[model samples]
Target: MKNVLLVLFLSISMIIIYVFIPQQQSIVFQPNDSNANMAYIPTKEETQFKIKYTHSIHLTDVVESYKITPSKKIHQYELMYEDFSIGMPSNAEEGETFEVLNGSYYIKNMKRIFPFFHLRIGQVRANHTVIFKNVEYPLSHSIPPGTSVKVEIRTLNFIDLWKGVNILESL
Candidate 1:
């Protein structure tokens, strides 16, 4: 009888612990560093061709959405043609200081130049509709002509929940 009673008590205690204890919640951001983790900012170079048309989309639509409060401060960064290439390099210089719209096209910067600049439209957390070039796309869609598109990022925090953590670290 004593053993049975002890087991019951322990089971109840464990249940209580599980119910009341809160999971650790963390805030993550993208482009973690302002300078693209580079040692110094590179000189701004002129582009050969004019930017014909630009369509912007928010990150929340492309990537898994997270809660963002209005009170959270937004940080801005700009990516120009010279800073990014086809494939992302290990040591790319992230530029500093630019005006970025919160709900717009999402683009990433890399050290080397590539043929196409990757772009994503729509985010899970997007509150309103995003109309680009007179057409409406789904909640999330990949933008084509990656070469012509420029990317700007606006976020409350730079740490991203999904892409921030290293896959190996979880293991």
Candidate 2:
């Protein structure tokens, strides 16, 4: 009787902990308006991801590399683009370095940190794609074109993860 009771109690406690406690952190993309849906990609600290998009004006590729900090903040550490015009940044900020590497212009050591930011998916020409863990997730796959999204990091438990859409569904 004692052995059976102890086993039951331990099983219940584990289930409760798994359901209520946050086990992992993920990069969550929340819709800015009513036009889109929410999605998430499981991630961990020190993981690197890239948002690659086509420049609306220059028609070139622009890659923004980011790394998640230990505190779960988004750290944008590098920017790579082909040209400088219109909305493109002409030079690196005070502490960053601008250099040309392998025919592409790179702004290394950007050190831009953001708790959250707004991303506007391109309607026509811009194909905004997120590469996480070497998997490509195009926002337009699950979200409507031209939809604006709020990007943020969130800690989630199994229940929350089950409720949210996994952007990797398309993969």
Candidate 3:
């Protein structure tokens, strides 16, 4: 009878301990160290091109512009050409004349659509000419007998994360 009572008491004590004792939950807290700002910073490079041509051609209109801004805080804009031999040849027709105009291709405005995606938009300025013989040549006509211009273009480059680990490791 004593052993039975002792067993019952021990079981009751165990139940009380199980119900009253506070259990600790295991929780883990980790922070992300590689985010867009830290991992995916953009870079820029300067590209050069040498254009040399001599031919009789006609030019009506030429438009040049560039705009690349992945985020509102960062912007990359450039004008037509850095250096040029843009002018009319001395042997142009008696009434032949040309005009070189300087202007901004792409104006920077604070506008951010997608922060991650970036694009380059612009046109490289080139020397061109048009020849009008005995016919009545309008003032708008432009002719270049010879052209030798050095063009420098600036571009924005970003690291693509979707590439495989080997590519990333090489970079």
Candidate 4:
């Protein structure tokens, strides 16, 4: 009788821990450390997100669009930049399209996939912006300067989401 009761108890505990507490998926910008205050949760969609930053030397805007696959891999689809100077890409690789539209250069049909990428917040000139859900956010507002944030998708529970940062409250 005691053995059966123990098994039941364990099963219930496991269900409560795994099922009772719901999990939410979001693109998390976690810094080098486990400092949740420095982290940012931009969106819950596993569809698309964008990172826009200004060139340090040229001071022109550069936008990179990424799509999150169903398997959680990040797929870079397009890149838009002001010009072709100061380390900017001149032409697209094999099968990619390089075109000019409205005085800007666009490299479309990108096929680069990565598990995750590190984004080091610029101390001086990099005005990095996170755009998703038709909104733009200033990344420098939450994280400290020069912090290398690991950008990835994380399945966070309520406690984790509460601890992490969310800059979309007003919207």
Model number with the top lDDT? 2
Model 1: CA > 4 A from native: 24-96, 99-171
After superposition, which runs of candidate 3 have C-alpha atoms over 4 Å from their true positions? 26-171
Candidate 3 local lDDT, 79-120, one digit each (tens): 232233354232223333233446312222223222222211
For 1-171, candidate 4 gives per-residue lDDT tens digits of 999999999999987787547477677788876453645554565388899999998999999999888877789999999978878999999989999999999999999998889998888888788887768887877677777889887677666667777756523
Compared with the true structure, model 1 gives a TM-score of 0.23
RMSD of each: 17.7, 2.5, 24.5, 3.8
Tens-place lDDT digits, model 2, residues 54-123: 9988899999999887778899999999988788888889999999989899999988999988898889
Highest-scoring model, TM-score: 2
What are the clash counts of all predictions, listed in order? 24, 0, 6, 0
Of the two candidates 1 and 4, the one with more favorable lDDT, higher being better, is: 4
By TM-score, how accurate is candidate 3? 0.16
Q: The CA-based lDDT of model 3 is what?
A: 0.25
Q: Rank the candidates by lDDT, best first.
A: 2, 4, 1, 3
Each candidate structure's TM-score, on Cα atoms with residue i matched to residue i, is 0.23, 0.85, 0.16, 0.83
Worst 10 residues of 3 by lDDT: 24-33
Locate the minimum summed-lDDT window of 10 residues in model 2. 37-46
lDDT score of residue 18 within candidate 1: 60
Show model 4 residue runs off by greater than 4 Å: 1-22, 33-38
Model 1: per-residue Cα lDDT over 114-161, one tens digit each: 322222322333322222223333312222111122232222112232
